[model samples]
Target: MTSQDERRAFWEERLAADWTETGVGYRALGRSFNEWMYRVRREVFLDRVGALDVDWTRARVLDVGSGTGFYVRAWQQLGAASITGSDLTEAAVARLRDHFPALRFERLDVAEPGDTFAGADFDAVSCMDVLFHITDDDRYTAAVESVARLVRPGGYFVFSENFLHRPAQRGVNQVNRPIGWITARLDRAGFDVVHRSPFLVLMNAQVDAGTLWRKAWGGVLRAATLTEPTGWLAGAALYPLERRLVRSRTESPTTEIMICRRR
Candidate 1:
């Protein structure tokens, strides 16, 4: 199989085994930390998107790479008129259907050709933390094009991506791309960036490797890895600090939420 095929198979198998934290690679950080991280990231994503001044009650929403459908629930709570979640994995789609029977769910691979949603478009498309995993140049371009097509003209596409330009390997995949490269692709795909904000500024994989406190905490967590419940407490304590630091930064962050408008 090709590298892209290998990556797709990897995610399918991984999500099939554990659709929650493992699907997103949060399991290693402990349970509490994982939950806390998810909550904070969701909040940041919504906050950035909210600044766009879109009317959620009248919006048709599409969430690409929906995973376990956390954002699907968020949009529901926000009173979106319609919400559809698409995932590449059968396990994620099944769990999403079971958890949210009222919403539409589809099995989609953004890197592939053709319309996975039957030429249907939406007012907003949320493709959070998914594009970076499309590591190959051709596949990444195709995925961006596919996602852009799913958004109506003048609609929004909100996504989270790692802006760290350095070469690094995360898990079984070596998936890091520069911020300029991503924006250029999106621009070609008929999208213009509107707003961007950082999430997890202070505590991240890079920082955890070098920082003393982070290393020490990581060591403690590693020692008591089974006590997943307490991980959130540590995350809770770290949240405010991260938020404040991120807000103070002016440069590009390791990861950021970008709000793009389709032209």
Candidate 2:
């Protein structure tokens, strides 16, 4: 198999085994951080999408790379008229199908074209925390183009991706690109960016730096076996502060939440 095929297989295996461990919330000290992160992201998504403007109660929604059915559940909670989830991994699709039998689930790889949503376009498409995994250059472009094609003209596309002023790599899998490069690609795919914001600046810094403050606080929590509750309390205390900081700054965010429109 080719290198790209190998990488895809790697993700399929990892996701099938346990997907939650990929994020902070699944870790022992991640309870609060995870909760805070999801809550803020939901708020940002709703605000940027103008939830009030869209009649979600009767709108068609599609979630690409819907691992673990998180965003699928979010859309359902919003009372979407219909919801469909697509993923690259059969394991993910199978599990989601079993859990949310009422909603449709399909195995889809954004890099290649197939009958996504049965060729029916959607009012809103959400591709969150999934694009960075498309490390291959050609495949990345193809994936962007494919996602753009799924949105009707003037429809919304909301996604989160790592953005840096310069290219960087986090481990072997994540290939973070500059914001200009990503925006240029999206523009070429006929999408116009309408809103953008950092998703997790403070937590990213703390985790990346392994700062003494974070280590000490975590040590104390872990030492006392207060990992879960203490972590949650800390997250609650920092949520407002982090939210304000992320909103006020726009340069070199660890991950960016962007709301765009098909042009």
Give the Å shift of residue 72 in candidate 1. Answer: 0.9
TM-score of each model, paired residue for residue: 0.87, 0.81
lDDT of 2 by residue, 1-263 (tens): 13666766876887777755234132455545566667776666665555436788878988998888878877877888989898888888888899998989888888885765557788889998888777777788898898888888888888988766655454466677767888889999999998787766654433222358657655654543356676677668767977787767764235678888899
Query: 101-152 in candidate 1: lDDT tens per residue?
Result: 8888988888884656768779999888787777677888888888788899
TM-score of 1: 0.87
Compute the lDDT of residue 194 as modeled in candidate 2: 82
Per-candidate local distance difference test: 0.75, 0.73
> Candidate 1: minimum summed lDDT over ten consecutive residues — where?
202-211
Clash count list over all predictions: 4, 0
Candidate 1 lDDT for residue 119: 81
